[model samples]
Target chain A: MVTNEDAARLITAIKTSSTYDFTDYSDKSFCRRIEKILLDNNMDLNQLIHKIGKDKDFLEQMVKDITVNTTELFRNPEMWQTLRYHILPKFKKNRSIFIWHAGCSSGQEIYSMLILLNELGMFDQAKVFATDINTDMLEAAKAGQYKYRFNLGYLDNFDKVIKENPFNFEDKVDVPYEKYFDIDKVKDTIQMKPFLREKAVFRKHDLVKDGNVFYSKFDLIFCRNVIIYFNNKLQSRVIDMFNSSLNRDGYLILGSHESILGASANNFERSKGFYKKKQM
Target chain B: MNDYKAIMIGGSAGSFQVVSRIIAALPANYPLPILMCLHRLKHIRSGFVEALSIKSKLPIIEPHDKEPLKAGRIYLAPANYHMYIELGNRFSLSTEDVVNHSRPSIDLSFFSASYNFKKKLVGIILSGANKDGALGLKSVTDNGGLTIVQDPKECQVPTMTTASMNATKVDYVFSTKQIIDFLLKLA
Candidate 1:
């Protein structure tokens, strides 16, 4: 239903006014999301573009909606298992570890990583950079308040992964639900304790338009389950960015369903669920 | 009954009870592969397979990538991946993006079923919070496939089933229990 003309107009309007560039994303996916956006707002293509050109907040929301931010803490247990067993142990030898949980939605996965590091005794040595395009989600991540019910699953997953690890395993790291949360009697909320709060620095970063925010390199990056929304071209570009962002032997973890196929596959080696940086 | 050797059901939000009842009523010897495309939060470990496994006589498994489709088994889409059926009885998985804000989107599975199985496909839209399966049900019907929808009055979240009922001329609209009974008869 999206004609070439509609695509061109939308691209041009976004490029001229907005900070993000979605021109290179897959046309089919972009158009589909755009149509849904229009429907949601009850606007036709021209009307939507007119609002996008004039309203910054509207444009920001559109970008967030279009980017596909559905993610979970410890999504695909196998990938987390891979990270704990094969990847993090290698990083233990480093002086300090820098991890970018890119496109981290609501910081659940970042917290999951922090929990993993805490269990491994790497919490003191690791600094996590959690970024997403959604400012609201980033703010929620900063607040670190979540419903107790949601945390229960991640806690269980973390416990299972840590206790089951074959190398340098420990059964003593008891991350009971009560340890990480303070039960608030007034509002019935579970506020995350200060210890889990200190590890992550949350920021708003758009993968498509904003240039790399990091001045230096990272030891590990988790960009899970985000690229499939992109067209092949955008996926490659993001992969290239991830490759460039990492130090030598740095790790890039993707979604379980995703692959570093075609051009990107040559840039890294599959090390468990992570793609370890190879010599360029 | 012709080309579709399987049926794929997709729903979200208010789908759990509906899906459970539907699967529960199917006969033990049902011959079609019933693929589920329920939307689950990416973090929660899904017990959908186990939840339905005990209720149904058929085998239920979380489908793996490239797992070949076998008749009479039920495959639930793993959380965070879009489950698609291929032409040669193979399954393809995609993390490509969320359609209708869902990864294991009902629309994606239904549309894929429409294209891949055409007239042989039987797409069902059940109780859900969103309009995901409406267009997809239309696609299936347009492609000469049979389409069924849960009656809106009987659904926990009727918006989605209502949308499908309004959007397309579905073959049948029944209560979840009746729909399951019908599937058993068809099988």
Candidate 2:
């Protein structure tokens, strides 16, 4: 296991050797991830830091390993229901709906959004942008393929959010799963349809250091499940950035379990499963 | 004894009634914050805190990610997430893959709390069907903190307490009544 001092040393080594800075990450989570990495690579903190300082390939791999990338299609069903019934309709009148998926790991969320937009007939009017710090995740997002068995549970989320209208029990839509993606149970793969895969613009962008890389005010920014890894200072900085990046009354949707803390939370009015930028 | 900054309790299976009774016994003015990591059904997000709150004088909460830890309150690990007590006395939640077949793994929570508070912390393990909290209780000892286990002879399920005893030499093997007595002494 890595000690707190060893974690600090590793963070500093990574910062000095690369442009990445983890100074503002939650210390406990960072240390735990490092401990896992150390165990997996069969190296102590000193050896890991030594390789980080010397080998670029090894350093890149280490950085990627440090990032938590477990994501599934429509992970939170209720949040998607809120987006579908309540949030999306509010933006329907707008000619172009700008949606940004910041820290969009593995792109399940972006596809999730696209499927929703297409269902609502708002796809043509939507401009979607996705970004992540991990280039590997970006590539995986582009491929838009996931394990069928592993994500089988989340497929229920798709049905809950898409096919069934919660407001009316009799209002059931017969939308087949193949309409959005192809599933091969024998191969254990779920591949996003080619059109859905190509809809979003994917980029490699770091949330900590980068500032509004898209340079457009978004109507809805989904930074779900991403800010939990950040410390209060970094969370505030990112929240402030999201506050600025959003249009007036724009939505900032986070993971169900995540909420804004500190003074930065003042920028948004809390709604069910999401936050709306408060009008100045 | 009064110098202890926090108390961490890990339990599962038949531990709820034990925890409820302990919390019911604690006064509202209890000084140290109680951190609990109990194995729970991941999909059921609500009602756990409300149920736990029914018997306690202190406020029971499933802490949001990065929420600051406060004294005189019971912080239950939220469903489907790992809760950590960070160095800054704030709570950080993680959706990282499950450990020991549990998302809110007892070992992970105890590890962080023990590291943060060191000798100023007290770790307790209660009735559990699994051995998740064994290494975590050992971590408390490793970091010079006090460790306790509900006496296995008195536990509904003895695996966790037994495993913890085999993992490290705990400071106390208290019954439910004795555990309450130990906490009240701290207050």
Which stretches of model 2 miss by more than 4 angstroms? none
**What DockQ would you assign to candidate 1?**
0.14
A1-280: candidate 2 lDDT, tens digit per residue: 7777888898999999999999988888888899999899999888988988999999888889888886778877878888999999999999999999998999999999999999999999999999999999999999999999977876788888889988887999989999999999999999999999888998888989998988689999999878899988899999999999999879999987799888998889998968999998
User: What Cα-based lDDT does every candidate model obtain?
Assistant: 0.76, 0.91
RMSD of each: 6.7, 1.8
List A-chain TM-scores for all predictions: 0.86, 0.98
Q: Give me the candidate number with maximum TM-score.
A: 2
The CAPRI-style docking tier of model 2 reads: medium
Candidate 2 DockQ, CA atoms? 0.76
TM-score for predicted model 2 compared with the true structure: 0.95
Could you tell me which 10 consecutive residues in candidate 2 chain B have the lowest summed lDDT? B40-49
**Candidate 1 stretches greater than 4 Å from native:** A1-8, A26-32, A149-152, A162-173, A185-188, B1-77, B82-103, B111-135, B142-167, B170-187
lDDT tens digits, residues B1-187, model 2? 4499999999998899999999999998999999999998766766888898899999998888888899999999988789998888989999888999998999999999998999999999999999999999999999999999999999999999999999999999999999999999999
